[model samples]
Target: MCVEKTPWELVIDFHGHTCPDIALGYRVAQLAQREMGIRPAPDSECLVKAYTQSCALDAVQVLNKATIGRRALIIEETQHHIYQFHFTGTQEIHQFTVSSDVLDHLKALQHPDLSPRERQNKVLEGVQYVLTLEESAFCQYDKIPGELRKL
Candidate 1:
């Protein structure tokens, strides 16, 4: 006996914008490795894992189109606000979606009370401290408020 099913096309559009916080993480890791001699991130294993997962087909959808014949299932997602081919499937498959967690740390860092100068200084100091073995002279004494520097 043979079985036949109605042809259909399914498209899932996940609409959301990914901010640059992810890039900030990469910058931090790069700074640590370059200046402090810390191990660089996105290690080989993780990179390989990401490539493997991304290359894997997620699903297959039978399309009713006449000329094209059938449409491969697609699972689309946005990263850093760029859209890319997430998954392709030849057979029915399950796709995994990663939801972002609201990082409380970011909230604290983003507090408006910190003047723009202060915020920039914090980012700079944080990066500097993380990337150096010796305490910088600027860090030892009271930090000259970035405001004063402008004056």
Candidate 2:
């Protein structure tokens, strides 16, 4: 018998491995879908503007159907885990910023003292943390004032 893969499974497969960044991206994509409605909304064209570069973008592409190949995902190196979503069907834009608490933990995982193995283990733990974090604790969301979505 064959079983279908969950969205998270597909994202992990595409990303080649799981990490905090991938988990972060997964949560962001799921929340964006919740906030903006599922993909292929009638006559809708969706674009994602990410303020940082990381494996998280993979989740957005896998789950949100916003891919760099399609020119639907743009990255600006603001060094923050902020993601914005725009749809041609609506003037409103949805924005999500990873919370500082989570960011702090992610930074702690990067300490120089930890051995490579230790860091890897901690990162896996972080993946679980990010995946299980309370919805409100994971990120902050907002709806920006409607404006023409620029290409």
Best by lDDT: 2
Error of 2 at 2 (Å): 3.0
Whose TM-score is greatest here?
A: 2
- Model 1, 38-122: lDDT tens digits are 2234331100001111211211111101111222222233342111111111111111222122223333455578887887765
Q: Which stretches of candidate 2 lie over 4 Å from their true place?
A: 39-41, 147-150
Q: What are the lDDT scores of the predictions, listed in order?
A: 0.24, 0.89
Q: Looking at model 2, which ten-residue stretch has the lowest summed lDDT?
A: 142-151
TM-score for candidate 2: 0.90
lDDT of 2 by residue, 6-33 (tens): 9999999999998899999999999999
